[model samples]
Target chain A: MKTLVYVAHDNVHLGDATLATVTAASKLGEVHLLVAGAGCGAVAEAASRIAGIGKVHVADDAACEHQLAENIAPLIAGLMTDHDAVLFPATTTGKNIAPRVAALLDVMQISDILSVEGERTFTRPIYAGNAIATVESSDAKLVITVRGTAFDKAEAEGGAAEIAAVASTDDAGKSSFVSAELAKSERPELTSAKIIVSGGRALKDSATFENIVMPLADKLGAGVGASRAAVDAGYVPNDYQVGQTGKIVAPEVYIAIGISGAIQHLAGMKDSKTIIAINKDEDAPIFQVADIGLVADLYQAVPELTAAL
Target chain B: MKALVPVKRVIDYNVKPRVKADGSGVDLANVKMSMNPFDEIAVEEAVRLKEAGQIDEIVVVSIGPAKAQETLRAALAMGADSALLIETEEAIEPLAVAKMLKAVSGEVEPGLIILGKQAIDDDSNQTGQMLAGLMNLPQGTFASKVELEGDHVRVTREVDGGLETVRLSTPAIITTDLRLNEPRYASLPNIMKAKKKPLEIKTPADYGVDIAPRLKTLNVSEPPVRQAGVKVADVDELIARLKAMGVA
Candidate 1:
């Protein structure tokens, strides 16, 4: 089986999600990496060096910049003619594009696959990770999105695969990139962060959310996250939300500050290696899953913890 | 203009699904069922559009067992003009659902199609995109904010890094994200009115689509459980333990 893996990126560097997707794709057969972006030669070069990849297919064009799904989906669909299976990283970009590709090919897409049972069989979590379903597809072609946390990141440097260019396709003019307001942060990305420090609704406001959570996160060099309640309260952007409906993170160390840990919030980070909860509520649901639970006022404990660290 | 919205009936989000002892699937025999949370958002968005007079009609469609009619009625109570139930017992896949929606879209010629980004039960997140592809329509997915302009729609999407705004022409597809809107509960009066709303029941064959189970379930099992560890006395001890565990 020949598999084409869509490398999720930002036209600069390949994210850890791509490496994990490559690892999942390798389970199928020979893997080829597809990088779609403008002036992304370095990303393609990086992709070619990943172990187990047979080739790196680059589609460098202005239209592909920012990976407008309208443009990238067609470029991917046109290339799917040669590959038996297509895999994506299950990031926002992948989720946005893979379905369009499946629609174009008249195929069903298997998403957030947790385990690959066979060439066409996969296990995926449903109901926000509460239930797991094993499905086998008989579609002639397979389009899949792999959850990054489920697989280990493939070695970044090893093999040297040949780099080739994929032809540019016509832009549908259906959708165009208006603008983006990305968070500028020095800490690691949430999904790939080694440590995450998240706040809940108890943070009160955005200023407090930053004043309390960001300091600890910065002290530990951890990614910052918020509970759905915090995000809904306008404490942070939606991207910072870590829950069943938001981004799922499984960092090595996860600290929940002032979080009551609803089941939805737990679903996203319960797999962390070491879970710590700092909340005034002694019986917060978060403590049940927390490896180290601390019952205290987050206002005092968080600052003290940050200062000590 | 007409807005077509697809709602899925699934186990309520609050229910923790239990895998059957036989390993066939999640136990849904007596589970509390409701419209998928994301689909509820989609229905709410469409209803808001209709109320805003941006769209003249809002059509809600569901594909499932006879019980799916309840899901459609719920949408109607929320102000959808009518309901379509593609009744089926066979487990339907995303591709088949997209095909059926495409057929419905062709017949309805809706100005816009709204759907949940994914159904919580399957969590495939593919139907809206697949439907967009089948109909050769533009798609704005994972939308948190949707605004209709004269001839196009502007959507704000919650992406990995932050938010991204996109503009798409009319006759587009927009999938609902979590922050799309707070769905309103159906009042008793609206529920009564929904009982009189038009509901057309059809099958996949009526739309020339096959509702076959494309995927086979090998087994259903739970994820590896994480054991509860020792609780620290204070923040100092918590840090000490984390350091000892080499996690911090």
Candidate 2:
């Protein structure tokens, strides 16, 4: 099988660049890495070192700068004819782009791939993430969205192949590039954060919100987060949101404060390693998923917890 | 302007989902079903737009079993002019749902299509974007505020970054994030009015949509159990532990 991996410098590059190599070595295939833009020469170089990659394909164009879906989707569909299977790192960009590419191919698209059980199989979450489901798509030309964080990145090894120019569109130019604001934080991103601190609507007012959420995050050196209600209430920014409508976070320790643990919010943080919930309501939905539950006011508990840590 | 909203029957948000002993899936035999929470928000947003005179009408749709009409009523009660159910027992993927709606969008020629970011049960947040892709329209996902500007729509949304505002041409797709709006309870009068409202039932085959399972599910399993950790005796102990772990 020839596996073509579509990678972006911002979202797809990881410590080991494993998505480029994992199925590459595991399954006998020709691996082609599509470094979507420039400055990811490092990522392409990393892909070449992986044992299974047959060639490194760089779709370099000034329009490829941001990998806007319109330009990349058609290009990937065009690339679909060359490969038996296509994989993309299951980032936000991956979630949107892979399926469209598959739809164009009239094939199956598997999302949030945990592991490849076989050449045409994977495990993913379902039902607001209360359970993990193993899935298989036997379609000839398969498109898969791989959770990049799940696989071990391969160490850099070999020579990088020459760059190739694939036809890309100015569709990104057609669509308005509205203002973009990245959530600036020294802490790791919620999706990839090892430790996460989440506050529920119990924070009461926006004035108490940062005090309730930020201190706990600071104490634990964790990324700060909020339940959908808290985010919706404008107590916290959307980037800090952890839930079904927001981010799916799988971290080592996820400390949820004042959160009611709605099913939607649980779906996002349920995959955490160490789950702790601090809420005034003992019966809050979050308690069901937490390893530790403290039925107390988050206001009193959070400050003391922060000071203690 | 016109609006399109999608509602799905899901296990009530408050119910605790049980993993079946066979691990086939969660049992929904006797579970109370309700309109998916986010879809209710979509309906609420559309209804609000109508009340504000921004949108002239709303057409709500659902793609599920026959019982889905019950879910559709919840939308009608919220002030949708009419409802459509593309009945199917087969669990439909988001992409196929999008394709069906793309056809519906052409028929109705709605100015905007509103949807829940994902149905809580299936939890696939793909349909809105796929519909936009299939229809070749601009999409403003997880919208917080959807405003009308003459012939175009200005959608304010919470992106992976901070809030972003996008201006798109007519026929845009806007998905509801939780914070979009608080759904209003259907009043007793409105509930009575909903029964008299029209509901058009169609089949997936009628829509020329083959609702096939693109990704086949093999098994369902519990995530690895997390071991309990002791509470630190003091701040100093917590600091020491952090230092030992190099997290400090």
Indicate the worst ten consecutive residues by lDDT in candidate 2 chain A.
Answer: A16-25
By DockQ, the best candidate is: 1
- Candidate 2, residue B9: the lDDT equals 92
> Candidate 1: which pairs clash?
A136-B215, A136-B216
TM-score winner: 1
* Model 1: lDDT of residue B191: 99
Candidate DockQ scores, in order:
0.74, 0.40
Candidate 2 structure quality by residue, lDDT tens digits, A1-309: 877887645533633334533553345366777777645555666656665456767666665655556567778778778888877765556665666676667665777666778877777776766677888785778777766545555545554555555655556433444566667888877766788888888888788987778877877778888898887788977788887667777788888888887877877777677687777776676777776667776677678767766
Summing lDDT over every window of 10 consecutive residues in candidate 1 chain B, give the lowest-scoring window.
Answer: B223-232
Model 1 CAPRI rating: medium
